[model samples]
Target chain A: MAGQPHYREAHPLVFVMTHWVNLICMIMLAFSGFYIHFPFFPGFMGVARGMHFFAMYVIIINLTFRIVAAFTVKTATDLGSREVDTDIKNWLPQEKNKHQFFETVKYYLFLRKEGVISAKYGSLQKMAYLATIPLTYLQAYTGFAIYGPTMKGGFFAAGTTLVGGPMNMRIIHYFIMWVFIVFTMIHAYLANIYNFNPSKIIFAWKETDH
Target chain B: MAQEAHGAIYDLLAVRGVSRRDFLKYCSYIAATLGLSEAAAPQIAAALEKGAKLKPALWLNGGSCTGCTESMAQVDTPDVATIVLELLSFNYFETIMAAAGKQAEDNIAETIKEGNFILVYEGSVMTGQDGNTLIVGNKEDGSPKKGTEILAEAATAAQAVISVGACAVDGGWVAAYPNPAGAMGVQAFLDKEGIATPVVNIPCCPMNPEWVVAMVVQWLLVADDDPAVFLEKTALLTKTYKDGITGADVTLNYPEYVVGSTIHDNCPRRGHFENGEFVSEFGSAEEAMGYCLYKVGCKGPQTFTQCPVTRWNRSVSWCVNSGAPCIGCGGLNWVDNNAPFFKRLSSMQMGGSLGNVQPGSVAAVVGGVAAAALVAHGLGMKAAGRIGDGPPMETAKKYDRKRMAKGGDK
Candidate 1:
C-alpha cells in the first residue's frame, strides 16, 4: 500500500489554532465541570467553578469563530488530494458524499475491504460534527438555567420551568457533558485508528507526501 | 365602634400576655418578611386592630405528617395562640382545634357555607385509589368522604387558598419516586379538576411559619380581603404545567420573593465558599469555623428559598447552620430531586428492575463502555487491513462507473 498524500489545504493554519482552542477548552470544561458537579476532592469548589465558567466562555467564543471561519477558509474537498473548496462545503454534505454513506459504514464494520470514495468527511462524520454545535449551545443554555444569578432572568426561568425546575436542568447539563466526553473519546480513537497522520496534520500542521 | 374594636384586639393580646410593643415589633418583622417597608408595619397593625371581624380560616390536613402544623406552633413573635384566637377564626384546625369527630367535620362544613374564608391546606393531595388513600371524615350517611372531596368543596368556596409546605405544593416525600398513594400537589389536582381557585404556594418540607404569617398579613393589608387583589399586590411568579388529564396548560402561582433567590446566594457561609474553605466532614474544625457545606452535598446552590435568612424554628438556626446540608425541601419534587440527601446530585431513576442509579456511575459506565468499544473496533480495523496507510480506496462506485461507461464522455 502507498502512503496517501497530506496537504495544508485540508486544514488551514487558523483552523488548527481554533481546533487547539476547542480541544483545550473542552478538556478544561469537562474536568472542572465534573469537579463542580461532585467536589470529589476538597478545597477546589471556587477554583473549579471559576475554571468551568472560564472554559465555557472560551469554548463558546472559539466555536463561534470556527463557524465563521468555515465560510472563509478553503480546505481540501477529498482525502489525499490538494484540490480545495470552501471549508463549509466539505464540513457539510456535498455531491460526492451522497451515496457513499453506507459504504463508509460498511468499510468500518469490516464488511468492505476497500475504503469508500467520498468527501473529506463521511456522512456519519458530518452529522456528528454538526450535532456538536447545537449540543454545545444547549449545554450553555441549561448551565445558565441552573446558575443561581442568571436563573432569575425570564429566558432562563422559562427554560427552568419548562423542564420543571433547576434540578432537571442540572441533570440535563450533566448528561450533555457525558455526551461530549463520549464524543471526544470516539472521535480521538477513530481519528488515530488508521494512523496518526490526521492528528499530525491537524495538531502539528505537518504535511506529508506519498 | 372601630376604636372600641381596636381596643378589644389589644385587650385580647394583653390577655394572651403579649405586650402592645411586642405586637407592634412582630408586625414590623412580618412587614419586612413580606418585602414591605417599615411604614407598612402601622398598616399591618391597623389590619390587626380591625381583627374583630376575624378572617375565617380552616387549616385542613390532607396526607400529611402534621409537620406544618408543628411549624405553625413554633411562630414566636405574635405567637400561634394570638394568630388563631384573635387575628383569625381558625374554624377547623385538627391539630389544635380542641374539637374532633363529628364536631370538627361540622366546623369545616359550616366554615365552607360562610363563603368568605381562607383555606390553609397542608400535605399532599392524595389522589390514589380514587382518593380513598386519605379519608378525612365521615359523609352524611356515615360513609367516608375522601380528603380530596373535602378539599375540592372547601377550596371552591374559599376566598383564597394557601398551599403551605412542600407536600401541598408538589406532594413532598410521599410523591417521591414510586409514590405509593399517587400523591400530587394541591394546585395540580385543582387544575386537573378545572378548579380555578388560585393557590399561593409556600414550599418547604415543613412550611415556614414566618412566611405563612407574612402571606396572611399581606392578604389582609394588601389584598384587602380580595383574592384577585392579593395576586396583584404580591409579585407572584406563575409556572405552567400541562394538566395530565386535560393536556391543557395549567398556570400555578407562587410568590416571587420566596423563590427568587437561591439559598446559596443568601447563605451565611457564602464568604467561606468564595474563600474556598469548606467542611469536607461533619463536625470537623472547619465545620466549627462555619465553612461552606458545598463539598458535603449542600443543595443550597440549586434550592430556591430564604431559609438561610428566615432561619427555622424562630430564627434559632437553619439546616446548614446546624451542619446539615440542605436537602432542597423547598424545591418542586424536592425528595426526588435532592435525595440520597447527602450526595451532590440525585440518583436518576433507571426505571424497571434497575431502579435508581447515580449520575456519576452512569457517566463512568458509559465512558468505559465507549472506550472499550473503540478499542475493539480499532483492533477489528487492524485485522481487516485498514490500519497503516489505511485500506485501498476505490476510485468510483460501481453505478457511477457504469454510468460513465455508457456515456463514454468526459
Candidate 2:
C-alpha cells in the first residue's frame, strides 16, 4: 500500500466537490421521492415534495456544472501519472482503452487473473458513466410530464402523449428511480472493492504518493 | 305550422312553471359555457325560438346501462323533456319517446332519409361475437341487426355524432382490461369503418348534462345546424389514442372547457392539500374536518376535467365534495387507467393467474430481486478472492504494443 503512487492529477479538487454534491442530492431526492410517491406516514407530504423538488434542481445544476467543467479542467489521463490532459479526454473513450473492453469483462468474470490495462477510466466504466448523463436527463423529462403544474405545457404534454398518458409516464418515472438505485449500489460496491483508494481520493482528495 | 311550432317552446316552458326570464337566464348560462360573450345570449334565445322547425335528432342506445340517459333526465334548467321534445326535436328517444317497436324504428328511418339530423349515441360499440353482443333493430332481410350496424347506418347519415358518456367516448368500463365483449368507443368504431362524420366527445361515467346542453345549444345558435361550422366555432381539444382492440389510431374532439384543466387545479379542498391536511381514512375525524382527498386515492391530479368547477348532479355536489375520490372517468380508457378506485395507482392486469397486480408491489419485487442478486454477486466475488484490493492490473495496452511493432511512435 505504501509503495503505490497516487496523485491529485487523477481527480481534480473541483470534481471531488461535485461528486460530494451529487451523492448528497441523490440520497435526498430518492428519500423524498419515495415519500411523495406513497406517503408512508401522514403530515410530511408538503415537506417531502418541497425537498424532492429542491434536490432535483440541485442535482440537475450539479450535473450540468460537472459536464462543463470536464472540458475546461485538465487531469492526469493515466493512473498515478504526473502528465496531464483535458479532463474530458479522460472521461471519454481514449486510445489506451482500445481492445481492452473484452479483457476487462474477462477479468471481472475471473476468466483472467489480472485487470485490463486501459485509460484513466476503463472502457466499461467509461460507458456506464457516460450513460448516466442521458438517463438523468430522461428522469427529469418523465418527472416533469407527470407534475401537475408542468404537465399541460406543449413540450411535456407531447411527450406524455407519446408515452401513452400521464399514468404511463408516471410509471416510467418510478422505474427510472429504481434504475438509479441499482446503478448506485453497484457503483459504490465496485468503486470500493479496490482497497477504498478510489473513495479516499475522490471523497477526501487525499493523495497517497511515494 | 311554423307559427304553431314557434309558440310551442314558450307554451311548454310556461306549463312547466318556468318563466321567460328563467329560460333567458338558462340561455345565458349556455352562452357562458360556450365561452360566448354575454351579448350573445339574446341571439341564442332568438335562435332557440326560431329553431322550432326541430332540426330532428335520433338518440340511439348501444351497449350501455342507460345511466347517461338517466343523467340527462336530471338536468332542471332546460329539463330533459324540453331538450328532447322541443330544443332538439328528438324523433327517437328510447327511454322517453312514446312511439315504440316498429313505430320508433320508422322515425329513425325518416330522420336518416331527411339527411340533416344529429345522432346522439350512448354506450360502447360492441363488436364481440361478430357484433351479436348487442341487437338493436332488424335488417332489410328481417334478421336481427347488430348494434354496430345500426350505429354505422345512423352515424353515416347524420350531420354529426355526439358521443355522450365515457362509454361512447372511449368504451369506459365496458372496454376495460381483457375487454371480452370487444366493446369500443364511437370514435374508434367510426375511424375503423372509415366513416368521415365528425364526432364531439363528452366524457364522464355518465357525462355531466350541462356539457351536453351547451354543445347542443352551440350547434343550434352558433354553428347554425352546420357540423363543420360547429367544429370551427367551438374551442375543442383533439385527443388521439391507439385502439386497444383494433390497434388503430382514434381521434376525438372534446370541448376545451370540459377537459381543459385537471380537477385538482380547481378542487375546493386544494388549500387543504397544500397545507398538508389529508383525509387518510374514511369516516375518520379528518373526513369530518373536510380535508383533501388526495391521500385516499384521488386521481384528480392526473384526470383532466372541469368536474370541480361544474360539479355534478345539477351542480349540487361532485365526487370529492361528497367524500369520494374521483375515479378519473372523464379520461380516455378510464377504467383501465384509474381502476382499483381506492388506490393511488391503477393496477396492471397481468393476465391468467396473476389477475391484477399493483404497481408498488411490482416495483418492490423488482427492487428486492436486484438487491438479492447483488448480495449473491458479492459473495461470489469474495469466494473468488477478488474482494479487497480487487483484481490485479495488466501491463501496457495491446493496441500500444501492436502500434509500436508497426513502426509507430513509442
Candidate 3:
C-alpha cells in the first residue's frame, strides 16, 4: 500500500483552486471580522471593514461557483481509489455510504477497533459540509441587516424587528463566526491527523500514495 | 373670540422680544423638521393665532430623573415660556408650574375633566410592587394613587400622548437587564391596559427638545388638533411585539423622519471613516482632528437619529462632536444595547451571579474546550491502535448483516 501508484483523480486542478480561495477568504474574513467587532489596534478600522466586505463577497461568489463545479468535475469515488466519478456523486450521499453512520462515529470514539467503509466523505462529513451552505448564507443576511445603509431597507428591517433589534442580530452574527472557527479547527486537525498527505494534495495538488 | 386670542398672543410675543418675523421663521424650521412643506408654516401660525383657547397640557412624571425636563428648558427658538404660556396652557407641569402639593394634584384633575388636553409623559411606567414603586399623588379616599393609575386616567382622556425621552419610550436605564422594578415604556403599559390612543415617541436619554417642539407644532397645525389626522400625516412607522401576558400583538408607532437614517451616514466624521482615519483613544491627536470614532465604540452606525444634523444643546454641539461616541440612546432597549458604552459590542446579561458576559470570552472558552477534547480524543485513539490509517474497515452496518442472515439481501 505504501508504494502504490499516486492518484490525481481525487481532486482536479479547478477544485484545488476553489479550495484555496475558500481557505484564503475564510482567513481574511475571520481576521477582519474580529477586528471590526472590536478594534484591538488603532487606525485600521476603515481598512478592516473594507477587507471584511471584500472578502465576504469573494467567498460567497466562490462558494456558488464551487457548487456548480461539483456537477461538472470528476473525482475519485472512494479514498485512495483511481476509479473516478462526477464529483457531486462523491460529495452527496451514495448507496455505499448508507448504514455505516454509527460505525464511523464509534470508530472515531475508539470504541471500534476497525474503521467503517464509506464513500469519499463519511455521513458525518457530508452533514457538516451541507450545513455550511445555509450557514454561510445566513451570516450574509445577518451582516446586511446590521450594516447601517442596508439595514433601513424593508427586507432587512423585517428581519431586525423579528430578532427584536440590532443588538440581538449582532450576537447571532458573532456566534456564527465561532461556529466557522471551530469547524475550520477540527477540519484542519482531522485532515492532517493521520498524515500530511491530505494537506499536500489539497494545498499543493501533489498526489500521495497510500 | 378668535381675534382677541390672536391679539393676546401677539402682544405676549412682542413683550417677550420675539418679533413676528422671528416667530414665523421658527415655524418654518419646525415645518421642515416635521417633514412638512414651507406652506405649512403659515398654517401653523394661523392655528396659533385663531385658537380661542390655549390647549391644556399635563407634563406628568413617573420614574424619572428630570433630565428630559431639563432638556425641555433648553429649547432656544420660541423658548420654554413661549411654549407653555402662549402655545399651550401649562395647567400641570410639576417641574416649572407655580402650583404644588394639593393644588398641583387638582390641576391634573381639572384638566382631565376638561378632556381635550394633550398628555406629555416622561420616564418609565413603573409597574413593580403592584404599582406602589412610584406614587405621584393621593386619591380622594386618602389612599396613594399610583403614578401608573394617574397616567392611565390622564392618558385615557387626552386627545394625544407624547412619550418623551428613552425612559418613556422604552424604560431607558431602569429597564436595562434584570429590571427589578418592572419598568416598561409608556406604549407597552398602554397596550397592556388595552388603551389604543396614539403615542408619539421622541427617544434619546433626554429627548431633543426641538423634536418635541416640532411634534407639538405638527399636532396643532397639520393634524388640526386631531389625533387620527396627526398619526396619518406624520408618516409613522410601526413595530409589533407579542404581549407576554396577553399573547396579543402590540403595535407601536414611531416617527419615520427621526428613526429612518443612521447617525453614521450623516456624521461629519464620515469622510474620515471612508479615508480610514479614526480616533483610537480619548485625548489622542486623532480625536483632536475629529476623526471617526467607529473604532472607539461609536454606536453611530446602528443608531438612528438626526443628532449630527440637529445637534444638541441648542445645535451648538452633539455627543460625537464633543469627542464622545453615541451610545445609541435612540435605539429600543437602549440601555441593554449600548451598555459598556466605550466598547464595540454590548455585553450579554447571564443573569444572577454571572452578570454580563463578553462575546470574545465566550468564543475563547468554546475554542479552548474543543481543543482540549480533541487532545483527549487523540490519546484515546492511540490507545485503541487506530491512528495511522484508522481501524479496520466494516463493509456494512449491523442491521444490513442481520437482514441478509434472516432471509436474503433484497
Best prediction by TM-score = 1
In Å, candidate 1's interface RMSD is 2.6
Off by over 4 Å in 2: A1-6, B1-7, B75-85, B396-410
Scoring only the A-chain of each prediction against the true A-chain gives TM-scores of 0.95, 0.95, 0.95
- Model 1 TM-score (B-chain only): 0.91
lDDT of 1 by residue, B1-410 (tens): 22334566777777778777777888778777878898877788887777657889999999999999988875456563345234778999988889989899999999999889999999989988888999977999999999999999999999989999989987788888678788888898888777888899998989788888778777877888888899888988776654333345656677877877889999988988866787888879988998888877889988988898888787789899888889999987788778788777888888899888888888889989988898899888878777887788888875587788899566
Ranking by DockQ: 1, 2, 3
- What DockQ would candidate 2 receive versus the native complex? 0.51
Q: How many backbone clashes does candidate 2 have?
A: 1
- lDDT-based ranking: 2, 1, 3
Pairs that collide in candidate 3 are: A1-A210, A114-B392, A115-B391, A115-B392
lDDT string, candidate 3, A1-210, tens digits: 112234678778898898899899999989988877866666677788889899899989999998998898888877778898888997766877788788768767767765666777788888888889899989999999998758878899889888878877888899999999999888887776666677778889898875
DockQ for every model, please: 0.60, 0.51, 0.50
Q: For all the models shown, what interface RMSD does each have?
A: 2.6, 3.3, 3.3
Rank ordering of all candidates by TM-score, starting from the highest? 1, 2, 3
lDDT of 1 at A171: 85
DockQ-based CAPRI category assigned to the predicted complex of candidate 2 = medium
lDDT string for model 2 (B1-410, tens) is 22334466677777777777777777777777778887887777777777766778899988899999998875546563354236787899898789988888899888898889999999999999999999977866899989999899999999999999999998889998778899999999998998999999999989888898888877877798888899898899988888888898788899998999999899999888877788888999999999988778899988999998878776789999999988989988898888788888888878899989888898889878878977887787788777665555556665666787899884
